[model samples]
Target: MNRLDIIQALMGQKNLKNYLEIGVENGHIFFRIKSTFKIAVDPKFIFDATRRFGKSIINPYNLNNQYFEKTSDDFFAQDAQRVFSAKKLQLALIDGMHEYQFALRDVENVLDYMDDNGVIIMHDCNPQTAGAAGCFNDWEVGEWNGDVWRTIIHLRSQRPDLNVFVLDFDQGLGIITKNKPESTLLFSPEQIKELTYNELVQNREQWLNLKSADYFYNYFDLQRP
Candidate 1:
């Protein structure tokens, strides 16, 4: 199944009333979700925002569905709490800046607002090629996953309290949930940053610890209350 399939499956299992999406280009996956409240953030929205989701079925589900024309950093810094009036986020997709630090920051920001049983999905966690997962400044060059997988590694190693799962599909869709007894990082950024994708490939089990879609499906099914 594709990433959307995984999202839809999870959405079906829970009361994901409050939804937030980062990097909503053309509302491709953003508009597909039927949540009670929705907030999409993207600095450079390519399509026309006002006319895109106009009069759609999902629009009514979230009448207060806001479109923030700003980067995740800006949105978090200035408009995060504003968007989340009182309710903690039940679901959030971190498909924003794919870079390691940026993605890590996105995860950190979401943790502050996420509910105890909330799930955060991050895109591009499993890179097929070294080029895709490698660090690169130029976006015009290759299919750069921008070391987003490192964020997964960071989360797994640093915060053992959080249940982390990498769905081995669609370049790796990461599913994260919070638990108790939060701990400190076992490895440093300097140590993680030193490893190359090739090295990561050699040590995928240690870093990624990915699971199949079926595994995730079962986990979510059993997780429902």
Candidate 2:
């Protein structure tokens, strides 16, 4: 599905109250989501302030909207605990850093704030492919390095309890649901090392076609296990 369709589906959900977006370039997604409270973080506040990137036209009417001038890593490492202490986040979108370590850290930090049934949507989980090459045009301004994809893989290995699904469309969006706490048995230490190493060597095209929802459902039936 496209971004609009995904946004519509999320808006239709009744449980969403608080929403957080890690990368708010122009508030496109922020403006789309209807929620009681919404928070957007980005270190390039000056850039956004200038509205040079064509994000200035976004309506400035949402009372619950809040924009923070902070890097994703800084927000995750220091501010997330305090910000989430009083609020129950029902939805979060991680489109900030596309690097492997940064994406992994973003997920680790946001998981603490997510409600039991809350869902986290990640952008650019699938790498660029010949057929899907044009999809990356929507990305803000950096090169796609498949960091988000690697992060999702690491999360699946480290946290077996999450109901993780990769949306094959829209430049590869990843949906991960937190259910319960459990032992980390899916990924071993050796596996993590191997995967990380392999990620560095894997071509973008290969990464983009690694697996899709159908593949997971037919092969692993991850939802059941």
Candidate 3:
């Protein structure tokens, strides 16, 4: 399943209302989400603002979307309180910088504002190749997953309070929620960074709690479409 399908299913199952999306590049996934209130954060958006507003005015589903043209950090630091004052954050998507530190901070920061039982979906946790998982200096024009998988490892190791796992699809769609984790790792941050892609591949399923696509469908009791 794709991010949108997972998101919409979770929204339906949880009766979620408020939505937050970080790293909204083209509004490809952001605008399509159905929520009572929605927030989008990105330093540089590829979509036209006027078109977004027009779509908002035209469709009830697209309405109430707030866009912040700033880093996720700045959005949380400056504008989070004002918006969250009225609505409790229910679900969020973290697809920003695609690096470990940024992705980790985005999760932590957004968690503070999330309602009970809230969920956060993180993108790029599963880089298909070692080249895709390369660090920023090695960044290329296409298919750079960065080290976001390390964030998952970090959370899985240190934060037992959160349930963390990667659904083995769509470049490793990560699901994070407030619950007891099914598995835990013993790696320190330094050890995680020191880990090689080959090492990760060796213990991929255990390290990431990697579940098959069938697992997701079964977990949610949703049919394949």
Candidate 4:
């Protein structure tokens, strides 16, 4: 399933109405979610702030959405609690800065306000190539995954209370839940950062708890689209 499909499935299954999306550059995915309460955070939005990309602007669901043109850190520190005062977050997408530290902090910060049944979906957790996974400064252009996979490794290794895994599609969508983890990492956080992409290729299944598309379908008992 695509990102939207996975999200919508969870939305229906969990009865999730509150949503938060980090890195809503163009609102390609943000506006698509018909949530009751939603918040969009991004350092700078690329599209016209007043107009919808392709959807209707008059939909009342859109009116419930809030936008913050600030870094995820800034948003959390400055106004996160105030905006989310009435409702806890049920779903969140971490797609802001692709760097490991930023992505790591984004997940941690969101976890603080997540609802009991909440889930967090992290994008770009499996860079397909060295160029795709290169350190941020060395990136020239094109698709830059930028060491984000490291965050998955970090979470899996550091946060045993959270179940972590990756669906091996769409640059490897990382799934995080506060359920009991089936396994814990043997590697330390420092050793995890020292790991190379080649090593990841060899240990992807074990390290990322990689799953097939059917695994998700069966896990959630949701029919494939």
* Candidate number that wins on lDDT, 1 or 2: 1
For model 4, how does the per-residue alpha-carbon lDDT over 1-225 read when each residue is reduced to its tens digit? 677888988887657778999999988888889887889999998877457523446555777678899999999999999988888999999989998889999999999999877889999988888778868898887889888888888888889789988999988899898988888787787897799889988987888899888988776677776
**Better-scoring candidate (lDDT), 3 or 4:** 3
Give the 10-residue window scoring lowest on summed lDDT in candidate 2.
129-138
Name the weakest run of 10 consecutive residues (lDDT summed) in model 4: 49-58
- Candidate 2 local Cα displacement, residue 213, angstroms: 8.4
Q: List the lowest-lDDT window of 10 residues for candidate 3.
A: 216-225
lDDT of 1 at 52: 65
| Residue 83 CA displacement from its true place in model 4, Å | 1.4
TM-score of the candidate numbered 4? 0.94
Displacement of residue 56 (Cα, Å) in model 3 is 2.6
- Supply the global lDDT for candidate 3: 0.89
Instruction: Report the error of model 4 at residue 39, Å.
Output: 0.4
What's the lDDT for residue 150 in model 3? 94
Question: Each model's C-alpha lDDT?
Answer: 0.80, 0.63, 0.89, 0.86
Off by over 4 Å in 4: 52-59
lDDT of 2: 0.63
Candidate ranking under lDDT, highest first, comes to 3, 4, 1, 2
The lDDT leader among the candidates is 3
